[model samples]
Every structure is written in C-alpha cells, then in structure tokens.
Target chain A: MTAPDPSPAHPVTGLDDVVHQRVRLGILTITHEARRVEFGYLRTQLQLTAGNLSQHVTVLETAGLVEVEKGYEGKRGRTWITLTAAGDQALAEEIGRLKQLIARVETTSTPEER
Target chain B: MTTDSVPAGADPRRLLSDVRALAHRVRLDQRLTWVALLVLAVATFVAIPFDYVGMDVRCVNGGSECQFSRDGVLYYWPAALLIAYTAIAFCYVRAARARGLGARVLPYALTGAALAVVFTTVWLLARVYLADPPTEPFPGWVMVLDRLVAPAGTIGVALLVLARLERNVALLVFTLGYLAVVLVPIDFGWTIHSSVRAEFIPQQVINGVVLLLGAAGFAIARRRQR
Candidate 1:
C-alpha cells in the first residue's frame, strides 16, 4: 500500500504570514471594515499593551499594509490607523485561504464527525 | 502560549474555528450595505401612510387674504428617510465597535441633520412661493421642482453617506434608481379646494416602488453574501 501524505490534509499555501499573527490578523480584520481605527481602540480590542500594539502596527506599516496618522483630536493627540489598498487585498486573501481551509475540512469529514 | 506560537495542544480544527469566528465577525459588519437598504425599506413603508401634503389653511393678512391654502411643506417622506438613515448610522457605529473598529457617531448624526435642513429649506421655499400672490400665477414648474427637491435631497444625503462611508455599489445603484420614483408628478399647484386623491395615488405608487426596490436590494445583497 502507498504511504499516506504526512502533510496537513488541508494546505493553506497562500496564508499570509504577516497577517497570520493573531493580533495582526485581528488588526487587519478590524480596519478592513472601518474607515479608520484609533490606536487606543485597537489596543483595547486586542487586549494588548500599548508597546505591543505599536510594534505590530509598525510591522504592518512597514509592509505597506496600513497607514498611521498622528493628529490632535481637540486638545489631545490621537493616532489613527487604516488599511491601505494592499492591506485590504491581504485581508481578503487571508480570509479566502481560511474559507478554503474550512471547505476542505467540511468536505473531508462527515457531518456527524464534524 | 507565547504571542507568536500556537498552543502545543491546539488541534487544527480548533485553530481554524477561532480564525473562522473572527472572520465571521468582520463579514457580519461588512453587511452594513444591506442594513442601509433595510432602513430604506422601513422608511418608505412608514412614509407611505402620510403621503398627503396637508396645507395650512389659515389666512395670513386678512380674512380670505391668503394666496394659497396648502403652501407649507409637510415633508413626510423626508422625515421618514431621515429618521431611518439616522437610526441605521447609529447601528453602523455600533457594529463597527463590535468588530473592534473605532468610529465616531458625530459625522453620521451630522449627515442626517444636514439632510433634514436641506429638505426643510426646500419645503419652506415652496411654501413662501405659494403664499405670495405675485409668484404663484406663473412657473408651475417651480412647484414641481420644489416638490421633487425633498426626496432628491434626502437621496442626496443617502448618496453622500454611501459614497464616503458605506462604499457599496449595489446600494448606490438602488439609491439612484429611487430618483426615478421621486420624479413622479406631485401637484403642489393644486388649489385648496382640489381633491388630494389624485395626488395621493401616484405617491402611494411611488412609495410602493421604493419599498420593492429597497427590499430587492437587501435580498440580493444578502443572497450574494451567503
């Protein structure tokens, strides 16, 4: 008998490593639907410290996936983040890969087993 | 357990489920276009019942001195659409929050307020023109234009919001399609003694068309999303 493939039954070769990070994935998904997201709001939602969120945001910014704007909202300084076109495309691709994963698993397993 | 690494015990199904859940949240929020169309449907239905434009019959200068009896704009449709849009805008703000997006409500509120102001201004101008004896005799087109202005202005606000905020092509198309319905004749030139049944029926038909269109847009969007 032929040996079975040791690799995962559902391979997601197109998965974006930049977006696959849990927190960064969260950030991209949130900003994809919003016009712009405040830095503070992203931190709160992701439950990350300011330093941690800023680091991830910097990585995204460097990749040209997100834009960061610093300005004053009234008297207080505020930072806003939004996905660039590339970021939007990346998120779409990530979700497409995820959907493929789900579809593959669904088809491979019986309903009762699933 | 670290930020970069998946848990050692994590099954692929479990990991995939978590990712799926997050994507589902974003997808649900992205469906705000359908919510906007639903708002239009509700607004049209609510506005349909109040289609008749009631005129202020009170004389202004002296007894029987008023040039027109039904001059002031009732603005039933505009009010309905405005209310629905405002409500939907709030829903959008909340949905964004739920999906980990930060959005301010002030802009949405301002959009609705501006629309109300525009509709009100058009109605007031039509009323003033009707009240004046000098301008009322000619330019029947002015009355028709004024009547068209309310819904046009309402849809204009909708279009602006859709363009800047929603950015949904199908919703934009439906809003534009609604303009054809608004173009149906409104008899603002009718005298105080004229019957409103003629005015009422066409408006009801227009409202029906709007409701159907809005409902269809919502359904198609929902289906495509599925």
Candidate 2:
C-alpha cells in the first residue's frame, strides 16, 4: 500500500504488484496494442480457464486497469476487454522498472556473472 | 535500497527476456507492415528504372517518331503499384488497431487520389508539358511485372505478419483479394505475350499459393483458439 517511488534509482520497489503478476502482465501487454480483446481470445492466448481468467480480470477491473464489455455477437454472448488509461500507464511503468532492474543487475554483477 | 526484496529464485535476466518477448509479440504486426512497405519501395525503385532506361521515342507503325508519348506503360504500372502498396500499408496499420474488419474507406480513397496524382504528373512531364518524352513504347511485360511485384511483396509480408497475429478472416480476405487483383486481370487481358507470361505468371502463381497457405494457417490457428 505504498506509493511508487518517483526517483529512477529506486525503480523496482515502485513496480505495481498488480501488473507484476505474469498472467495479468501478459493481458496488459497484449491489450495495449489491440483495440480490444475478446474474452475467448484472451483466455486462449493466456491459456487460462474461464473462471481463472475471470478472476484475474476482476482483479484488474477492480484496480481500474481494465474495462470489460459484454454484448452478443450474432446469437452468442461475447465479452471484450480493453486496458484503461491507468492500466496502460501502469504497464509502461512496470516495464520501465523491469528494464531498470536489469540495468542494475548488469552494473552490479561480478566478472564471473558476466 | 537492496536487491533482497526481489525474493528467492527471482532472475532479473529471465524477467527482462520475458518482457522483451511480450513486447515483440505485441508489435509484430506493425513491424511486418513496415517490412511490406520497404519491400515494395525497393522493388519499385529497382523495377521502374530498369523499365524506363534507354527508351527514347514512341514507335508509330514500326517507324521511330519523336511523338509526345511518355513511357505510359512504364509509368502507369508502377504508379498503380505504389497506390496499391500504400493503401495496403495504411489499411493494415488501421485494421491492426481493430476499428473493424476491412472497415476503413479512407485508405482506398487515398489510393485513388495517389494514382490520379501520379498519372497527372507523369502525363504532364512526358506529354502535355513536353518536359522529356519517352524514346520508345514501354514493354507491356515490364508493366505487368511492375504490377505484380509490389502487391506480391506487400501482401506476402502482410500474410506472414497477420498469421502471427491470429487474424484469420483479415488474412484470408487480403490473400484472396491480392490473388484476384494481381492475377485475374493479367490472365485475361494482359497475357498477350507468351514470353512475358511465361516469366511472370509462374512467379505470381507461387506468390498466390504462399499467401493462401499462410492465410489458411492463420484460419486454422484462429479456429483452434475459438
């Protein structure tokens, strides 16, 4: 429940844990480029069950990182998901932090590690 | 601050690699679209100059006359291809944005406008304005090749890109439409020279098959996902 540190040197600690989770991170990365993703498409890509994906999506929705839409395509019910502005920003910051973490590792590693 | 908070067994290198892969996947379509554009651009550059070089006059009834005809055949084919390539790139980028399936009309309109401009400029330079008239009748087969090369590369690259993106119908429509546009007209109206047809037809056929196969793969992948 701490605010993300604004300084570049402390990037990793500020990483949004919500976006740090692998499946949700994947969803955000995919949806950031797509106009919106169908629920089925997301489920298939992430290899998550209907219930599992719904749970992750609920977490994202609760955090205001994603918006879910329900409608019907032809005779079948359909769900579509898209990242919200906050979600997009969170994903960007998370990626930036990951890059910074990698840079830190590179700088601090021993010669044998290199 | 210490790296202790990274938790046990957390590998920074692996995390970076994973995120990089994710980003690469997300941007695949855009990268493919640019490749398609670049391929067409290079093909046009190489093909047009070869077709236009050493042509000095229009042949009227087997007599070389200093007539006011530009290399109309040469100019028109590349012009058409340029319009087509640009249209496809613009459409692909927009469709990747997912407004709808083959939905936007602006690219098509822009293509028409581009062709008109090319036609007008080439015409003005070669005929009306009398800047520099072409020396001879441009070869029909070269024009045919020009028509084929650009779309072949543009759509060919697009097929590869869309296959990765898992956009089944878009890939199918684009492949089929490419075949129809590039192959059908040449077969019916322009295949007058056997030598020209022999050289280019087989290549076009190969391109068509590759595009269709790629589209089919995407379709299969999409079906499995559904």
Candidate 3:
C-alpha cells in the first residue's frame, strides 16, 4: 500500500481525527512534556472541570493518543495519564503543519494587512 | 521538540534510540526491586547481635526440669544483617523504579518481608526474655525468613522469565522438573534414609512444582507486547 503524505514534524502522519482538534491537541502536547502526570493534575493544569477533563481524556483515549491507568495507592483510587508514542508523533506533525500554514499566510499577506 | 533534532523525516534509528532508552530505565528499576525485601533479611540478622549478648535465658517450663539458654554471637549476627538488609532494600527500591512493571513483584515481596520482620521481633523478644536456650535458638524467625526468601527466589525466577532466554527456560524447566522427579519418592515418604522422609516433604515438592509454573509464566510474558 502507499505511504501517507509526509509532514514537517513527523515523517509519516496518521489519521487527522484527534491531532487536528484543538483541545485534544492541547492535552496531548502537555502530556508529551510531562513523563506521566496524575488525572487531577492534568485537569488542574488544563483548567477544565471534572466533566470536561473526563470527556477530553475519553476522546484522546479513543484515538489511541493517550493511556489512562487507574489503580489504588491505598484506600483512595488514583489515576495516571501518559501520552502514547503515536500520540506524540501525531502532535509533532500537526504542530509543524499549523506553523507552516501561519508562515504562508504571513508571507503572502499585504504589508497593510500585517 | 522539532523534527530538526534528528531529521526532517522519520528516522527509525531515532525512534529506536528513544524507545530503547526509556526501556532501559524501566529495566534498571526492576533489577533492583528485591533490595526492598532485604529489610527482612536484615531484621533476621539484627536478632543475631542480641541473640544472647546480655540477657540470661532459661527453659523453665511449668514443672519441667530444664532445656535451653542464650549467647552473644546469636544476637549480633541478626542485628548486623538487619542493617545490611536496610541498605539492600534502598537499592531494591531504586532498581524497581528503573525496571517499571518488572518491579511490580517488589510490593508483595517487601510486605511479606515486613511481616517476617514483625515475627522476627517477636521471636527475638521471646528468646531474650521468655523461654530460653543454651545457644539462643531463634524460634519462629527462620519461618519468617523463609517466607520472604521464597518469594524473593520467585521474583528472581520471574526476572529470568522476563528475560525470555530460551536456554534459560529449558534449563529452569529441566531443573525444576528434575527436582520434582527426584522429590517424587521422598514426597511419598520413600526416602532411602528413613529420617529424611517427613510430613513436610509434600510441601517441598509442591514448591518445586510451583517453580516450574513460574518458568512457564515467564515464557509467556512476551506474548503481550507493549
């Protein structure tokens, strides 16, 4: 089969379903930087409520961009989140594509429109 | 952050390097997992220092004549070991963090070890104060040590299993299977030496069987890829 078209950040990009989205992209970007963070920590950093955070996590999970692990530390249940390699690569490619588009828009624009 | 770090396009070498580094860090943690269990080992040894160093012990049963006593070396050995075990435990925790999931065996092993430590403290206390012996024999400490040691041995075997060395599996399987084969007669109380045959022989054989199972489990660990 033919390979997918190459992107600037990534050699070969996968489905655009999750990577093209805004909030999911934000979530994946933050996760890639932090090795592995707690669910509450992510929610706090994202400034999203319990419901919003949970929904975003589900979307990312479905796209295989993230892994959500929940286990008990003691009496209380704890959840940890981490970005999958696929998610990381996808994010990089998306960021590259976005920047390239912005550069094109700026360079082609009239000086007055700047 | 950018593809410029390596190349503009995908580089299998770059990806492999990153993945390999992360994998190595995780393994380092697993390798050192058992150091945590060493605490129990040290506890057992701690009892050695105080074995019979100062106190005078005696087996003064309700109406019995006499039996045992205590000494210095007995106490010193266990005490020294306890210190050593603590050092070993620190290393183990560090290693566990390195190995990632491989270190999962640590918690249970350390907990069992901690339990053994508790029993050891009780046994040593009893030896120093209550019923005593001439040589200050540790009463229930050995069993605690055994409980911890057995799991440690299992974890070691698990690591071997994790490695998935084909030869090692065959060797381990052979060794365990051989032991099970040899233990057959003894477990059934048919040892050439009458004294060798005991009620606990079955348990020993059972442990051998379990070892074989552990080896089998390791062989299958790779079936589920990361």
RMSD of each: 11.1, 10.8, 17.5
Relative to the true structure, how large is the alpha-carbon lDDT of every model? Answer: 0.62, 0.56, 0.47
lDDT of 1: 0.62
* Per-residue lDDT over A1-114 for candidate 2, one digit per residue giving the tens place of the 0 to 100 score: 999877554666676777777777777876776647768766766677888889888989999999998888678787888889999899888778777787887787889877
lDDT, model 3, position A36: 58
Tens-place lDDT per residue, model 2, B1-226, is 1111234225656665666665554444333333343444444444434334423444477544334222433455456555655666575656544421222233433543455455455545545554554567568775544443444434443443444454335554655655455543434343423332133444444444444454455446545643
Task: Write the number of the candidate with greater lDDT, choosing between 1 and 3.
Answer: 1
For residue B22, give model 1's deviation from the true position in Å.
14
Pick the winner on TM-score between candidates 1 and 3: 1
Runs off by more than 4 Å, candidate 3? A1-17, A112-114, B1-226
Look at candidate 1 and give me any clashing residue pairs.
B55-B70
lDDT at residue A28 of model 2 (Cα atoms):
84
Model 3 backbone overlap count? 30
Candidate 2 clash pair list? B56-B135, B57-B135, B57-B136
- Tens-digit lDDT track for model 1 on B119-204? 77766775676555564355767655654566544654555566455445665666555655555443234324444423444554
**Model 1 misplaced regions, further than 4 Å:** A1-33, A36-114, B1-28, B51-82, B102-109, B133-144, B184-194
Which candidate number would show the highest lDDT if scored against the true structure?
A: 1
